[model samples]
Target chain A: SAVISQKPSRDICQRGTSLTIQCQVDSQVTMMFWYRQQPGQSLTLIATANQGSEATYESGFVIDKFPISRPNLTFSTLTVSNMSPEDSSIYLCSVGDRGSDTQYFGPGTRLTVL
Target chain B: DQQVKQNSPSLSVQEGRISILNCDYTNSMFDYFLWYKKYPAEGPTFLISISSIKDKNEDGRFTVFLNKSAKHLSLHIVPSQPGDSAVYFCAATPGVGNEKLTFGTGTRLTIIP
Candidate 1:
């Protein structure tokens, strides 16, 4: 299992503001992913971040709304742009091992937009 | 469409009993399944996973049983403890090696001592 950490454990922001969540891993990883969990809902994959390439976003999620930056193998950032009430959710980052399929997640950033 | 579905929203289990959480998927392309446990304010923790080629996979007290024909899978936790009380989510991916995962609505398990 990999050790992952995310900045801003919890935050309350005004609507229309933006927040950037950072994820750092202890060791180098090949794949990192961003996910969102809304109230009383399941987790939805936002995007996959790999170092030195553009992030691959799932359908219904766009880079404009959620921009991701993977500068290195152990660090990534996800910025929630133009936040709204619907954007209030837990943002989590996960790192997949180099050869293993199991992914370990960081303590998520809980964002509440009012 | 919701590709993965967990029918039960909550479950109450006595301590030392078995906790069974079920999940179903409509897509047959899903060849890998994983289970995660989430606490109130933390990220979901990966528990166990099973591949389509296998029918059962066990690790310690947690075991995952998959029935590909029915497109259904279940996680069984024997001798449930207080630490086992959390929201359990079942996720699926078409392949392995950190592919995009589709998650199901989690089932909250409460263990009564």
Candidate 2:
């Protein structure tokens, strides 16, 4: 299991503002992903952050709206741009195990857009 | 459409009893299934997983049973304890390695002492 952490555990932002959440891992990992959990909904994949390359965004998620950065194997960041009330959700980052299909998630960042 | 589904939103069981959480998936491509436990204000922790090739996988008190024909899988916790109370999410992926996971709506399991 990977020890993952996210900064700004919870935040309340005004509509139209952008918020960037940072994720850090204890050890280097090959696969890092971003996910979102809306209120009363399941976790949805936002994108896969590739090291030193552009991320692979899932359908319904775009780069401009949710920009992701994976500068290295142990760190990544996800930014929600031009936020709206609908953007209020828990943002999580997960690290995929190289040896298995398991993914370990980070303590999520709870966002509230008002 | 949701590829994975957990019909029950919540379930309660008495301590020392068996707790079963069920999940169903529509996508036949999914070959790997996993169960994750999540608590409020925390990240989801991996509980157990079962590959399509295997019908059952067990880890101590946690057991996962898979029925490929029905596209259904369930997690059974024996002798449920209060600490077992949490939201359980079932996730599936088409294959291995870096594949995106499709998660089902979680089932909130409450173990009454």
| Among all candidates shown, the one with the greatest DockQ | 1
What residue pairs clash in candidate 2, if any at all? none
lDDT of 2 at B111: 98
Q: Write down the TM-score of every candidate.
A: 0.98, 0.99
lDDT of 1 by residue, B1-106 (tens): 9999999999999999999999999998899999999999999999999999999999999999999999999999998999999999999998986888899999
Residue B42 CA displacement from its true place in model 1, Å: 0.7
* Regions of model 1 farther than 4 Å from truth: none
Model 2 chain B poorest 10 in a row by lDDT: B92-101
Write down the TM-score for model 2: 0.99
Each candidate's DockQ: 0.79, 0.77
Tens digits of per-residue lDDT for model 2, B1-113: 99999999999999999999999999999999999999999999999998999999999999999999999999999989999999999999988766899999999999999
True-vs-predicted CA distance for residue B101, candidate 2, Å: 0.4
State model 2's lDDT: 0.96
What are the per-residue Cα lDDT tens digits for candidate 2 across A30-90?
Answer: 9999999999999999999999999999999999999999999999999999999999999
Tens digits of per-residue lDDT for model 1, A16-65: 88999999999999899999999999999999997999899999999999
For model 1 the local lDDT of residue A20 reads 97
